[model samples]
Target chain A: MSALLDSVLATAVPLDRALLLAAVLFSIGLAGVTSRRNVLIMLLSVEIMLNAANLALVTFSKVHGDPTGQVFVFFAMTVAAAEVAVGLAIVIAVYRLRRTTDVGEVAALHEIDYGPVRYPQLEGQPVHHHGSSGNGDGDGDAGETGGQPAVASEEAHG
Target chain B: MTEVLFYCFAAVAIASAVIAISRKNAVASALWLVLMFFALAGTYVLLEAWFVAVIQILVYAGAIMVLFLFVIMLVDLKSEELAVMGAPRFRALGLLTSALFLAVAVFVVLNTRETFVAAADTWDRGGALEVESGSAAGIGHYLFHRWVLAFEVTSVLLLSGMLGAVILTKRRLT
Candidate 1:
């Protein structure tokens, strides 16, 4: 009976344990975001990450002599809610257009046909990696400033 | 005693969170996330932040979760159409990268380890109520007095976010 009760209860958790829990939750969320192609999953993963942050903040506030960390958690929650609202709106817009939510297929903004990507030894074709930040159906004008496959800024050591 | 509750909550929250995010169905994922939020709220209570614990339940588990479910319903996505999870080769790379990140994060947490040895004579220990800095009322004072400007800004942000969502998706519901 004593052993059973002992199993049920535990000693006081150290500060590190809280931090450790936060880290675990954060990492799990991070991995979920990376692995999940669904935009909704990514957004949910973001929520998990935000919750981890809140956990850490509250823990720190208790350890120290302050309520600032808890206050910060409220701010975080507000931001998170706002972000989800906006993100879900965007996701809906995208889904309506393409009828799919796959991030890979939603590559309308990808750098199309620069050159043989990844293998830079066949021929050191000048890589025109001029990065474009524009997002619209009409991104061709921006690509006009695009360089060749490989921009030889420096002399290629033949 | 507190340690036991903390560990149990933490373990269950993490496990459920994993289940939540890994589920293929978005609705299932949201449900799992609700479990996580509840467990997290329990941890907050254990930490003696009763107000935060209440808000955690009310805001995160209650309001936020309902919003997520609503959005999920609106999206009404099919599993087949939801296929943007990258390729097998790239998926492996992402997994490896996230694993590395997880390892580094754990290492940092361990390195910065600090135990939460609660000192005597605070309101938490059935002590005097003279020093109530970490209480909910204290947090409210800090927010309205010290961080009032930021607080107002957050309200504005929330309003704008609501307006933006309405503007973005206000079409014929087919």
Candidate 2:
């Protein structure tokens, strides 16, 4: 047991370990952004990426005993806050129009006609048909669906 | 003791990050992300970056996460709709690509061991006097003095971002 502990301690240099953790976290965030269809979750993944970058910055700051990296992290945090504000506003706007947060549902510019994008998960329910006219005005056409009333009322509330 | 603590924090951070990304529900994902941020804050403390650690908790775990949760609630996705991740093939491809990227990053870090060691030696030679660099006082000295211009720029950026968000979300201009 002592031998195992010694090995672990000896191998775990704080700087290297922290960098590795940042890298892993970054890759996980990348996976999240790529796999998740929900725009909100994608934004969350982006935050993860920014946080990983901040971790790396702080780790390097410690290594050099310089506060510049920490200052940069402060700026990064500010930028991230701003980004989330704008991004969530955009998400809310999109959600208001589409009534669904799925990226698949908002592919008004995908350049391919898949015959009214289908949500296999929401089986037997009315699929939020979009882009069938191919005019790239999916938002306007979305009003024809059954979910339109709720979105309209929400827009009015806003 | 520090080594043990570092490992514990790293483990928690990684585990929570994995869970944060994998959860089907955005609210669950946001909550797990908060846990991950806390773990990362612990790691920051271990690194002696006390100020950064505090900001990590305040800005990330507290404010940013609350914004995420608010949006999640506002969007209010049904459980069935939230379950619809992308196609299995795309997910597999993404995971594979990120795994490859991780491999490359780890390789680069390992190969640059000598460089990092040299940097550490330099710090030991002259940087020890500034050991308080991670403290709020230390950081403030640089932020307000040397980086004041950048600081002002950041304020402007924040102002613009606020205005842009307001314009984007407003239902009507009148």
Give the distance in Å from residue B114's predicted Cα in candidate 1 to where it truly belongs.
4.7
- Per-residue CA lDDT of candidate 2, range A1-158, in tens? 75654454332245777888899999999998888888888888888889899999987886766789999999999999999999999898777767878998888954355345332223234455433343244355445454454454445444
Residue B103 displacement in candidate 2 (angstroms): 0.7
Docking class of 2: acceptable
Model 2 is docked with a DockQ of 0.29
Q: By how many angstroms RMSD does model 1 differ from the true structure?
A: 14.5
For model 1 chain B, give the 10-residue run with minimal summed lDDT.
B114-123
- Computed on C-alpha atoms, the DockQ of candidate 1 is 0.24
Question: lDDT per residue, candidate 1, B44-137, as tens digits?
Answer: 7666566788888898888888988988888788876554465778777777877787788778867665334433224346432224554678
- The lDDT per prediction is 0.74, 0.81
